[model samples]
Target: MCTYESSSCQTGETVVIGENNPVGSGNKGKRFCPQLVGTSESFFIPVNIPSSFSLVARNIPTDQTKIRSFDCILRINEAEAGVQSTFFNESYILCESKEYMYADDLLQNNVSVSVQWNGQHYIDDPTDTYVTLYKCSVNGGSCSRCLSPEATPSFLNCGWCGTECNVIESDVCQSNRFVNQNETNLCSAPAITDVRLSHNYFF
Candidate 1:
């Protein structure tokens, strides 16, 4: 069993969402529990792509007694772009662990987070673990999964729509002598004024 966030939660905010008795085997939770270490990763929609944001945890054991590898997958509109693992195949952990991933090199706005550990067992139940999630937003920009009617569409490779101007950089847009109906690039495609100015020379 694993815990995942349904929506964005701020970093450093803690919530207790699970509980069970350790002594009672009938329906009692595991006698031993590992606490969740606090660490968080954040992501933003690309400054030019179209996508949705999500945080996910997979392969996590609900029992808490057993130690095994777990994976965290970050998705953009459910599209896979990045993945990270915890308690790798070679290692195991008796307690919940924390893992972190920084911004950069994201694909489809996908990110994976994982952890590695050495495992052993101990008995003492009545404990809880929490998964904390945070979202990264630009100083004055908002994130979106699609472009507005006035905004230009992003390159196919982009993951989320962000605060930067973009053009379909194909040969058609580059040629001053040719006007291609299929190609269109705009200087004010982004929602932010500064971003539009930053790319002003390109237009």
Candidate 2:
């Protein structure tokens, strides 16, 4: 039961599935499940979940035998959630769509529910297993900028200029050229380090 905190989630936590399948030598058949330990802030769940919230399960291979089968059940508080089984591979459980919720009350009270794998497994690995979890973006859809702090978190307005507004304009360079509107014979160029105009005008 390891707990952590990220920039977006305060209750980011992880649990090792090795306790269930502790038969193999080394990290052959182990799974890891990451879940939000607390509900201090709004966290993200995989958009791959079937409903606005549903339990998804995937059997990822962790050993050579690939005899990995478990009666894994997901619970949120006290209510049993619908567990949808997808695919199982030799490397690990591929229950990409099946996820376990923490509790039913938590899901009902909150817009989103934090999930965790708290069920017993048939095969217990000698070591530990890790389950992969994908976080959602600020929009609760995709994970475009969920992991990166420097990336733009939400949609940004580009204004009428569009992509041009995203670019930073360099200093203007003065050139000795003729102007159509003004007879000053001075022109301004883009991205010039120095100015060499004979006359300068303030506009």
Candidate 3:
């Protein structure tokens, strides 16, 4: 059995001696080297608004000197968060999102954390950790703002009917609704009140 304090170990060594008491070299056997092991705790610190928060990782293992740095990756739901900042540290890492991440960015109000060595190297900690964030309502925005392409977190899924926001597949916004999911020119058509009919007609 190996303990936490044990760095290395060897097992199953055999030694054979000749009849004249001549000692022969013994087999070194299999040796086990020390492995990186640690636990990570993460949390979200609200920086500016409910949609903006800084990711903080703590209590990471820093016993290995060969590990140059740790890469803290932020995952929204199950996909990679398209933040511009790259967080790096020796024991822990702190990263702030460049773009705003709204409540719609998360599936369950939680963001996943994946800590790696350097860039692509994996660590001994296989378990994934998550940090919970404040859930802000995505509804109640103007039709133009809801359907605008410049909106942060492109997955906002805002509907252009009476300023409502929801998943693209939701039936909340029914008539005169334009979802901001995929289709383009959704808000190009003028509203019913914007059309003015001319009285004079010539054939």
Worst 10 residues of 3 by lDDT: 27-36
**Where is model 1 more than 4 Å wrong at Cα?**
1-36, 40-69, 82-203
Report the number of the highest-lDDT candidate: 3
How do all models score by TM-score?
0.21, 0.23, 0.33
Number of clashes recorded per candidate: 14, 44, 0
Q: For residues 1-203, write the lDDT of model 3, one tens digit per residue.
A: 22222224224222223334444333222212111223454354321232323333333434444445655455764667533224433333545444335446332266665556546543333345665543213433554555555652444344555345543333455554645645546645545767677998889
The lDDT of model 1 is 0.30
Residue 70 lDDT (model 1): 38
Tens digits of per-residue lDDT, candidate 1, 99-203, equal: 333344332233332232222222121222222222222211322322332232333322122242222332222442321223234223444445333544752
Order of quality (lDDT): 3, 1, 2
Error of 3 at 3 (Å): 19
Q: What is the C-alpha RMSD of each candidate to the true structure, in Å?
A: 16.7, 19.3, 14.4
Residue 1 local lDDT, model 3: 23
Q: Which is superior by TM-score, 1 or 2?
A: 2
Candidate lDDT values, in order: 0.30, 0.29, 0.43
